[model samples]
Target: MTTVLIVASNVPAQPAVLTEALERFKGRGARVAVACFFDAAELEIDPALAEIRSFAVPKEQIDKRLRTALGRAPANRKIWLHAQRSGWLMKWARTADLLVAIDPRSVHTVWEMAQRNVAASACYGLVPALRALDAGVSAPVTTRLERQVSATAARGVRGARRAAISSAKTTLRKATGQKVMGTPAGAWLWTRAVSAPKIPDRYRSKLAARVHDSAVRAGRHAEAARAATAAVSRITNAATRAELLTKAAQSELAVGRVPERLHDAISAQLTLADSLLRKDRKRAATALSNAWSLASNRVLHFDRLSSPLVDDPAGYLAPFRASEAARLLSAPRGRSVPAAPVPSGRPLRILLATLINDNFLHEIRQRYEAMPNVEVRFLDLDDDPARRSLARSGSSVIEHKLAGHTPYGEKIEEWLRPHLDWADTVFIDWCQATAALFTMPDPGDTRIVIRLHSFEAFNFWPHLVDFSRVDDVVFVSDHLRDLSTAVLPQLLGAEAPRLWVIDNAMDLQRYARPKPAQARFNLGMVGVGSVAKDPRWTIEVLRHLRRQDERYQLLLIGSDLNAKTSVAAKQYADLLKRDLAELEPSGAVQRRGQTDDVPAALAEVGVIVSSSVRESFHCGLVEGAASGAVPVVRDWPYFAGGAHGARTLFPADWVVDSPAQAAERILAATATEEDWRRSGQAAAEHTLKTWDWTVTQTAFDRLFLTD
Candidate 1:
């Protein structure tokens, strides 16, 4: 049998290539053996080739002297050292008729083995080894001598060149070290070098990043920002300039601080997006997506008490307004025909569509399904994997809109066009990815209605939606409508869809259960899982209440905040843990995490609080109110002073401006059991009459049933 040996210093880049080469060798009647430097389990070779022997080097068995040398050596030289000490590998190499190195790291080891075993034919790759075998000859004597002479000459030149490069790298590392970068003179010298005229863009960007990172580590953040700014200013290419600034911004965000050049980075990316909009839409979409990610980072918005989006909506979004690429995304793509009135001839076909969130749709879906005059089909893209992937691809949607058509656009048509043809109207929840995707293909005469909740107004998805394809846009509260319109001016344009403020449909009657007199001392909050919920605000109110009456306790109902969501989230979560540590053990605060039966959980709550920084309608608070819990709402900061906000949405006395005000209201409402019961009863009656499904369903009917 002809023995063939293969050496791999690392896992094969393409395992299938090695597997196929092995099969071909076995078919030609050669016995195969593999020497793996890495763990054998990492190689996913076919188990059918069980007869092939695999020899793996044990890392622990190597001597200390050899291990120390291996650390400083190149990967190719390290493999040679490992092979020299492995007895099994040496035996296999000596016996093999054909030797092959599967990757560059193993080449040096194979070359040394070939010299020791001159009878064997040596090759650097599978194809070369196969060619050697096909030729039916080991290398000619003259060719082997010439190869040895050439290798000796090349080694001398390589050794000298490597020495020079190593010396230069060592000097450069010292010059940019933390001790040097901490000094102003060092920072100035590097900044000037990076921004020097005629420096290649690729090299300048890379050097700037290295210098900035070193300076930041040395506590010279201002100098790092200057270096990046100077480097970016000198970059002639818009894309490169955007990319370097974006990297600098991301590095700061990764460390949980807002970038100093955040707006500059966003503006640079928008400029690049605009320049590439017509010629290279895929690239433009990537640039725009990067800009959006930087602008809407959680550290700047959700984790903090105030957000730029709420503080200055127009100023925060000015870059997007100036970009032609963003304009194209928002540009009206009018439907061919206005939706026909709900057909009188047959039952009205209503399709309810969303990506994954169906929490808000249960009431509306059940209402329509029971109607004798309506036919209902609910489509959640998540139900089908193929459709789900297409729905979630926001970049592809942006590209398709800019290009006017793509294979992705065709797939969307294939997936949703049939449903559009069948339905009289489609009500899509959350003006997010699903809304943008459904609007990709013209809805023909099928009415498109999208509901904009609170979160979408702060993100990029609302811009991606084709509003002209929609017949009506629904908002759960007037405050949400105001914010959405301010963020997206397309809503007020000539081709904009009809905007309506419809209260979310909720079943309030189920929560109107009797509460025990002891419940008068219990304060409750339903949803505290997100940063926006501001559970810490409720904790502060609990602190105030407890100082006056030690009997007062707080109940938090929902999942704990997820720290893994972002660095900002982790910071907030860590602080929340400190608060819980002091209150949780003393019976002052309790957690009744995520329960399906909200009504049962609310039976112990005497006062319900909405401490969120923002909300579309604060559904949980309203639900608690429906259960006879007196509502204490913090004027949602995102829309506190707006024309139509929590103040206008709820009764005048229900909204409070601060934690102290909320504590005062809660104390007044729960002073006496009789007084608390009376207050809760009035709140319950108002919510049931104003916000219940029975009352809101008529507005939906007018939207769908009427033209």
Candidate 2:
């Protein structure tokens, strides 16, 4: 009997196709063994027909550190690494006459298996598997040495390619790493080298990224930017140009700075997107998706100190907004029926949904969950692998939006329609993928409300949300609402949902704690993981204050910034670390690690500083104020001169323009214990009255309780 092995990374979408193909293999007198990453029990195939087994490594079983290290490897390499760890797969892969991959994700596994078992026929899909079996029947028998020789020859060829690439990279890095590149002449020479003749496209791109990275490390941002622009301009292939420009742009973002050539990078992607649209809409959507991904990357636009989009939203995104394909994706699809009012005699079923970041929902969920008249269910879209994959399927989402029909659209309906059916009202937090997916399908009578926090305004997700289908679109602040509406034109349309500004829910009553007299000398900043938080500015404030009063010190609360999040983050973190090393030993600055009790942490903090370059709302400063700390809010630069800003959001006395002003205010506010305590009392009363859950919940209740 012939032996066959099949590997599937996910459950087959159409099991009938797989079952029919299996029946064909069995009719040919083959014994089959199936291995899948998902549970075998989910499959309906007869056990007597084939021996099925699961190759899934449970979450607990996976070494997270190892998985993270393997994450950077090629998809095929990662698949092989995981599969090789399974003894059952190794055994079957070696002896099988044929190997099959049920899905695209599994194709890598079969590809690796093919390399190992050269004698066996390997292919993807049912029809290809069937054909492989026939080819195997007529294949000439191979000796063990022949198989080994072929495998060794393949390895030699792959090794040679890898070695050649490695050598080229090493050579390029050395030539570009010279200090001479700091000057214009040197930069021009290196730029020419990158654009030199006989250089392969792959090598040239890699060289550009490496040179830009090295130049940035050498602190030559302008030089690096110029070199990348020159090299990209020399490239003829639009896709390759897009890739190189994107990589260069990402390098700048990695260090917490905007790319000097961000406009060029974005334009290249839009150009490519438009090019692809003429030939294939799906491909065009994917290109637009790539462009959006680069433009909306959190490190560059949201998590950083500033953004080009915030500077000029329409101008920054002019290329994308001009693209016909991007417009199609943003085109509003109105819901068929208006949301039905909450039934008077029955409990209202409300579903609170999000992909991740449920920090804002705790109070709202607790309130609804405790209410007798309301039943609440929370759906975290990222909590499930299936939904998570769907949420991240940017290309598929674009295709669905452009075509008005796709497998992805069907899947979204199948997965989310049940929740829509059950809930009288659906509140989606964060106008990201969850909001887009929820709004993709028509809501028959269910109310759809999506809340856009600060970050989503800077991302492509808000553009993807079909505002016409939404009943209420909420923002945390007027500034964020203005910014979001400015970028997403759909929100401005007459058919758009009712816009509302709802402050984030916070239980500030708990933060009303007394502080020690010495607390007046301490300045505290909560949450400093992103470069935008501008913790360095707080340090500058500390330095400025300490010169006058040595008693002044800064308390940096929350986890240290994670450099691995982006190249920009890593660069910022490095600079911060060096600065911290100098001040930490002298007690001028202290890193108070993350904690659950912000009130307790703030009790020792007399002055709470909002040194962020930008914010929708400085919740941390408010929390600190609620804890009896004097508030010192920086005039967030992004929105400083705009229609709405930190100045408009907070009392004028609390907002400062510069570090010197912040230091001046800090000194004046805490000049005496009485003045400090009095200022703290006033700020605390303001936050409690304006933003506390006690105050905000009423607005929330009106949103849900009112028809």
Best by lDDT: 1
lDDT by residue (tens digit), candidate 1, 1-707: 77888888778888888889888877877788888877767777775552333445466966788877788787778878778776877898887888899888888889888766767788889998888777763667887687667666676677689789878867887898778899989988987788889998988887888787778778788988999988988888888889899988887776667788889999999999998887888899899888888887887777766788888889989998888887888788788988888788899999999988998999999988999999999999999975678877878887887789899999999999889999999999999988998888889989999998887887788888888888899998888888888888889977788999998889999998889998999999998988889899999999999999999999999888877877777888889999999999998889999999999999999999999988889889999999999999999887888898889999999999989999999999989999999999999999999998999999988987777
Q: lDDT, candidate 1, residue 250?
A: 81
TM-score (C-alpha, index-matched) for candidate 2? 0.75
Name the regions of candidate 1 deviating beyond 4 angstroms: 6-30, 34-96, 100-131, 134-136, 140-142, 149-198, 213-221
Q: What is the per-residue lDDT of model 2 for residues 466-499, given as tens digits with 9 covering 90 to 100? A: 8888999898899999998888877876777899
- What is the C-alpha local distance difference test score of candidate 1? 0.86
Q: Candidates' lDDT values, in order? A: 0.86, 0.85
Model 2 poorest ten-residue lDDT run: 136-145
In Å, residue 497's CA in model 1 sits off its true spot by: 0.7
